[model samples]
Target: MPLSPKPDLSIIVPLLNEQTELPDLFQTLADQKDILFELLLCDGGSTDTTRQIAVELGGENSFTTQLLDTPPGRGRQMNAGAAVARADMLLFLHADSRFEAPDTLSIALQYLTSRQSVSTHPVAARFRLHFRRRTTHPSLAFYFYEAKACLSSEDCIRGDQGYMLSRSCFEDIGRFDDSLPFLEDLRLAKTIARQGSWLLLPVRITTSARRFETEGLLRRQIVNAVIVNAVAVGWNEFFRELPGLYRCHTETGKLLLFPLLDGIRILLASFTPDQRRTFWQATGRHVAANSWQIFFWLDARHAFHSSLPPESVRLQWTNRFNRYCAPFVCSSPVAWVASAAVRLWHRAMLLLCRRLEPVTKTS
Candidate 1:
């Protein structure tokens, strides 16, 4: 089959040592139907056969596939891919992402283009995310997370959902932040939400949940919350001091949160009294902004039990909180109290994990 001279869309995927995941990813791309898309596989210094496999399998695929070597960072790799892509539309996807329907991209692109035509603001889209986990059993935590992914709330839209936007809009929003080794997607997500608007695409993108599973879902989520909190409060010391806070996908194991908590404790202690007060105040504001999650969790429970779609159920409590309570929670005193509560909760969780680790190993 001949490739289109100007493809309808450019699909950019950042790769590290993803040799194990490449075959399935390629197969899914190959299976994409009714879409004239070019595939740019940006390899970020994979020390494995990832590049070789991409070359071998890319040749077998019908689309225009190009492999480029880049520095070992997702943001750098994705930006490199976008710089050379021929299409007006760009879709950034994680290597572990899979599409259930062959026409997922086709429909997503169509929807995005349609929205762009009518809307004055720049439009970008992300698919609903589903975790392809190893287990078959129902988990309320996973369900809550999955439901949360469907919302357009701040910090809720993530990279794992597959970002699709026109190249012009991407340029307007600027390139992904490559300063840190991670959180580039998150930074861009917030930028888009601020500068333009996001549309939740109707299709779902299933991504491997190996990291969460291997690291223990609860543990991984807590670590993620910590990282997000650091980012929210401009806690540069956390990232600067602990550059390896986030491990690579292949290097994941049962996560130990004690070291992370201790690091935070040390960082807090090192801060001057004024700096500590300011940091806690900032953290309080972030916490208050996200306090809706507690109410949303209740809504999610009702939706889960009722077998309703994630967006279908909107409980009155969430509305009341937003209108009546959200403003009060953002106050400095309230923020300080919230910060104290968070610290207490953190210490409690650390103790719980310490007690549970030995039993988990024995079992």
Candidate 2:
């Protein structure tokens, strides 16, 4: 068939080693739910069967899928795919992500022609994720997150939430930063945010929770936190020196962190919602628990300090944690005074300790 005039939209999906999930993903697209659009799938080198699966799904002459070879890195692959898009709108989609509504492209096209997009930062749209559960229904928070994902703009996005951007908008913000290994989504968002209002439509897109299921929510959350914190400080710099940050250096650290996290989970279980409300009302935001597993820290006077013995450390820490968290819990001026006092005490002790300990010469 001869090439036609450029399509209205191109769904650019970047894939790498997604063999386990790629087929179902393509099948969703193959439904021709959005016939007016083109599918541009860019595959990075996959040691797994992902590329083969994609080829099979798309078939030799499938008018829908356009498979291309691109380098690894989600941002890099997406940028490469977007560059070749013949459509006026370029939607960056993940291989595992699925649209909850029918004709995803049809819904997105409506946004493209609208004047509402012009004044928006980065000028974008995204749908929410609805994970396919084989045995059970979706979780409470999952639905909430999915609901929020649809309406939140770049400032309020998670990477996996599907992004629909105009080709003009993509070019206006410059392409995704190919150099970033992680947190590339936020970098793209920041760039786009500088240009126009970050907009999230009410439409939802369902995506697999496989990453969290495979990696565990707590572990992934910690990793995400480290990445976000690192990006916030500066792009592409190591912040592993921060004790709370997670690093992939060793399985050994995870072994230790797991028990500490378990302790935290168990303690949280002990609180009734009403009791938790009372505790939270009494203590406030600064009431917390994270440093317990760090082997290097041992300051009793520190904010993280607990005089309770090692055997009772976990239990005691929980009590202290619930005690100090205030503003949301109590919202009292007394708590504010107490919070100020703690900060002053901490600063004074640090200064006093430094002055008292004479500097020693180092060879």
Which candidate gets the maximum lDDT versus the true structure? 1
Alpha-carbon runs more than 4 Å astray in model 1: 1-4, 350-363
What candidate 2 gets wrong by more than 4 Å, as runs, is 60-62, 116-122, 147-153, 239-363
RMSD of each: 3.2, 14.6
Tell how far residue 18 is off in model 2, in angstroms. Answer: 1.4
Candidate 2 lDDT (Cα, whole model)?
0.58
lDDT of 2 at 271: 67
The models' CA-based lDDT, in order, is 0.87, 0.58
Model 1 clashes, total count = 0
TM-score of 2: 0.64
Error of 1 at 93 (Å): 0.0
